[model samples]
Target: MSTETDPVRLSFRDVCARRLEWHGLARPSAGSRPADVARAMAGVHAQVISGAELGVGLRIAGATRTDVRAALWGDHSLIKTFGPRGTVHLLPSDDLPLWVAALSAVPPPREGFPEDVRMTPEQTEKVLAAIAEALQDGELTIDELNDEVIHRAGSWAGDLVMPAFQGKWARWRQAVHLAGMRGVLCFGPNRGRKITYTHPGRWSPGFEPAETLPALAHVVKSYLRAYGPATPQRFAHWLNAPARWAADLFASLAGDLQQVEVEGIAAWVVAGDTAVPAPVTPSVRLLPYFDTYAYRVGNQPPGLLYPGRARDRVLRGNFQALIVDGVVAGLWHQRRSGGRVDLTVEPLVRLDAAQRDELGVQAERVGEILEAKPRLTIGTVTVGGHA
Candidate 1:
């Protein structure tokens, strides 16, 4: 009676716990790329192991960045691997090749666009060629890069001087697409001059050859084993690929995944593992913008958290989320003044004192993770409540 649309749900707590188990049991002891390992161990975005704020929340499940890097490369080397959508992500030392093969060659942008909607190939090339040349030896800051991009495109660049660099899809997506093609810039660093696009060979010297499809198959198998009882759609969402492609990928790696009935629907569960551990007790946590918990699934299931509210908050694009007991309780934002960070939480429900306290602690950790060192304040503003 379970339909594919009605997936048997796993709580946020369960997802976090499973992430911990995978990090501890499956991650390589040494020489694994920090980014890939971060993605596989804690879902992409490196939220679980971001910065020095480890051993807290779901992130504590993973090893320290130093320990993780040392384990993978025999040296401490964690560089910004920013590519694809121009967002920085982490990469593992040993698994870069697998990620490259799986990701670098994204099928040419789904064609059939209205003509003159964006830039032509020649214009895109001119802009990207300038960028690659500019960033050939080193990185640039956001301001520097934006100016460079504007200069490169010249009169044909179009009007990109909007509120948030919008109108520049031609430059933005093209840069990311080219970076993806090169296979470096996997994830990135946001230090002083946080401009992305760099040569991987130059940035990360002495890397081992990336793994083959069999290895990628193993990694996918490991992903299911750790985060199983999940759907192909969910897997695809997490991996950022088309669901059908994910389905084919799953089918190709036979015997590694098992079909299980969840809420009466057929879903894939990790096959090798014999144990189904009870999830940790549900608790409130504040996730950052574009957290893995919010964007990791192949398809978005609003009912699990926001219900009718999903469309308003979680659009097709990424957004930060508020998680309660493994469900997205609502969305939150931060305002900074002096050394204090105002944690403004706009929840879909009324929060009790314990939940408020929990939110405060998590917010403090978030500030610390971002190196803001701000005093935490938790205040609830009631929004439209469901009857």
Candidate 2:
């Protein structure tokens, strides 16, 4: 156990390097343990299937997109759901029980929604029940599910036109996604151009909603192991829960974690993993949108890595990061057409021959995941220009 007053001391580089190892980038052969990568990194960002595949594939030594697909849709080892802040993530299916319990323990965040946009307590419950019933044994498209929701719950369920990136919702599957945040609904495989939804009970028949502090403790502990040396505020934001609640949870969990100092910043890691990690390997990465390495790396490092304007430009709207060694060195984007992918990397610093070679390897890894002809462009390198 660590006291708040006497945290173990460390440098910024130590934290950065440990973050890389914690994320599974340091492993020489990660393909053999894809589950370990998801377990350690927490989950794979999966708003885009290709990005999610690359997110997992990048950490693994020789993983194919098929392998990742198998884990989700075939072998059923991983599942796609609205995890951590209502974003799509591919989590190990076995951990879904704990996730449901942890998320359920948090107070509902209705206060944040605008008065006009917020669903009433009754409407929320109706929405939840409608979603689970509609998707009980069969998956349905959001549009199909929305129709079912309106049918079962009432016409009012169709009244809201909520804002969404896949265009305006104008339906209750929007609330079904909120129901997903509550851990009742999850994403099913795409049906042609449309996305589908199903209940986890169908996939993991063992799933049962049980409120338990130990489950939330397991959730927080798993987070600390991968992205720890983290603050309570960071943990709360990650869960989209109230900060004070997170603080209380941390206070209750002191025995399982240790306080640490990173360049004067106070953070916590699992008590069993308090030792400083060895130096980071000179690894290059073509990280995708919401890659846990880029998205869930806490809040402070972005300002340090991207600085003033870089953070806004590179991080906003699900952009990818081009990491050199252990920090954000640039931004990257990908566009796929038919059987080809065009990837553009904008590096912040000039690349040495070795760095460029490693970057090519990283790009090739991304290409392998896409199963498309990859045309990579290394744009003129500069620092923080896109932030």
Candidate 3:
């Protein structure tokens, strides 16, 4: 390992390939649990639940959507909650304490609502307390929880304020994300078609947030392990934190991190983790929307991971990416009707016979994960990007 003043030098290709290996893409982990995959990837984005399942399933041999769900709602090994950037994600249940502590430490973003639409700090605190109390017994649908919150907190909690889908959301709704990060709220199993919310204690009894400083250190180290040789700007982007705050956080932990030069660009990694493996050979993968690997790589230099058309087609549009040896090589989409799934792949670079065959095999794997029959077409995908 190199010291802060003695930076280690690494190539872009080596760094990219190393990240793939760390993410379990270069070689999937056999017989791995869903939580194992979730923990390794920091957290699996669950804004699109099916996409989250695909992201976790693809990293574990013989895993499927059912397996991920079982870990989430059945075995209590995984918990769905608000994570990085205040986005919904599936994280390891055991790690909730660390995540809650680290995430709660981040300063909240400036209020974006008008004075009349915004909740006062006191109201926000009262709403958070009500959320924790309401979920203490069991799960509650959003509507049911809303009534309970308004009843317990005050009518002020029910005031329509912040803008949402097509209408304004209740003033209390603004505190939901903060409630989740504070270990007071999380997603419960769905009731037929409607989603539900519950307290973290429902699954992990007596759950409590960890100490802030140690939790933050663990989060930073875990990030570097998965996507390291990265700058504070990249870290800030990944965490959705202010650039100045991330830079100061990095400086505070300088003794535990090692300075490095990735293709002449300055970066940092865990102090003892400086080894760079040889560049990976050609490999093809179909990554679903919001896959951690796809989104995290966006912070890297465009020339390295999103060269040429990929920057516009994949990163700019936030489309499902076709990864070839650690770089975004194309776009892909899947449409399912009953037991059949039709996959459309649009490759920016012409694939040879071997690569085409591998793509076919990858398509079959996706079908197995979804329990559908797959029909793959190596042509342009006409569908637009999804949120």
Candidate 4:
């Protein structure tokens, strides 16, 4: 009585364990290659500089903040750009060609831009073109980029400004992301405390635009290699793209992927990537807000969902997560006061002596990365929210 949608297949526990391998949480291969890790996670969230560093550092073998920084700013091997939901991320430099080509093809969200700063598709294209010219062989902070856009695109582009977290952002400010999505611009080294922008083509010399279909296929394979046995709907959600687009892309590549069942639901992963490994050693990870894995699969992360307990999903809008052996077990905070960084953790369950000691070491290491002495404190975790 097995059907495609309800096939007897791998246990939920097995699925969780395999996913941990994909996320570099399980017993993973030893390597400090940033490109490999970035490709694995699809991309790493980089809105918070330190968090993104910690997120990548934890996943890669013996990676350091210096290594992440060098990849980002020094070596120019990792391109910082906005991807999926228009959020900032550190994507591997070599992969930029395909990533941008496919992402640019995704139609804008149906709700469209706010009336206060709406744009025609033609207007958006012009803004992207102007941004490419301004950012060539030089860097500009958001403020400077805004002025440059108006200078290049005319005063009308300036009128396309909307209130944002920092200030009113011009319509061109939005399409500047399109410049990134189209493989033109990326983040440059910060001048003082303000972030700057530049051309990815200059930073990553070999960059060239690719065909959309092949680029979509490459992205799909990359995604499945790290987070597979996924449905088109999930892929669409991950990229914040229209459902029809993702479905078409997946269908076109159906012969290339292997069909598998995830807890009786049919899914597809890159061919030959379905092999599950042994369970991961129990350990704890202190992940910052917006950690890529924090956006776990299904309702909960693989580790949290397996072993069958009546528990809710842990990923939320904003909260630093404490993950234990691949499951989000709690939330944590680190704040610097004077010369000391206070580390506060709210554990969902009791920790043994060994676990506590392990946590202390992790806390001290976090302090080292932030270049401050750490003070560790463990508190009781309540049913919901921070206690």
Q: State each model's CA lDDT, in order.
A: 0.51, 0.75, 0.85, 0.73
Model 3 over residues 1-387: C-alpha lDDT tens digits? 235566778887788788788777887789689998888778888888999999888888888899999999899899999988888989999999999999999878877778888788888889889999999999999999999999999998888877899998888898888898888999998999999999999899889999999999888887788778787788888887888998888888968988888877788898978876665455888999888343454257666687789888877777888988788899999999999999999999888888898899899999999989999998988888885
Candidate 1 local lDDT, 1-387, one digit each (tens): 123343345444444455434543212234444443455543344433332123222254233435544432354244335422324444454455555555543344454344554566676677666666556566566556657666766755544422235444433444554554345333334455353445455555664335456645755664565456577678666655576876777787676666655444566766544344554433666655444342344323555445456446643334445666555667765666776666667676677888887777667666664545645544443333211
Q: Could you arrange the candidates by lDDT from highest to lowest?
A: 3, 2, 4, 1
38-65: candidate 2 lDDT, tens digit per residue: 7777777677777788778777778878
Q: List the residue pairs that clash in candidate 3.
A: none
Q: How many Å off is the CA of 210 in candidate 3?
A: 0.4
1-387 in candidate 4: lDDT tens per residue? 112443336666676677677777664347656666777788887888788887777776656678788888788778899866677888988888888888988877774567768777787778888888888879999888889889988888987477678877666666766677787788898999998999887886777878888988888887777667677887887788888988888888856877778766677777666677887555776777677343553223444432232134344424577766656677777777887988888777677787788788778767765657989989743344321
Q: Give candidate 2's root-mean-square deviation (CA, Å).
A: 3.2
In angstroms, the error of model 3 at 309 is 1.0
Of 2 and 3, which scores higher on TM-score? 3
For every candidate in turn, the CA RMSD to the true structure comes to 7.0, 3.2, 1.7, 3.7
Q: Which pairs, if any, clash in model 2?
A: 31-61, 309-387, 310-387, 348-382, 348-383
TM-score of 1: 0.66
Query: Which candidate wins on lDDT?
Result: 3
Error of 1 at 364 (Å): 3.8
Error of 2 at 163 (Å): 5.2
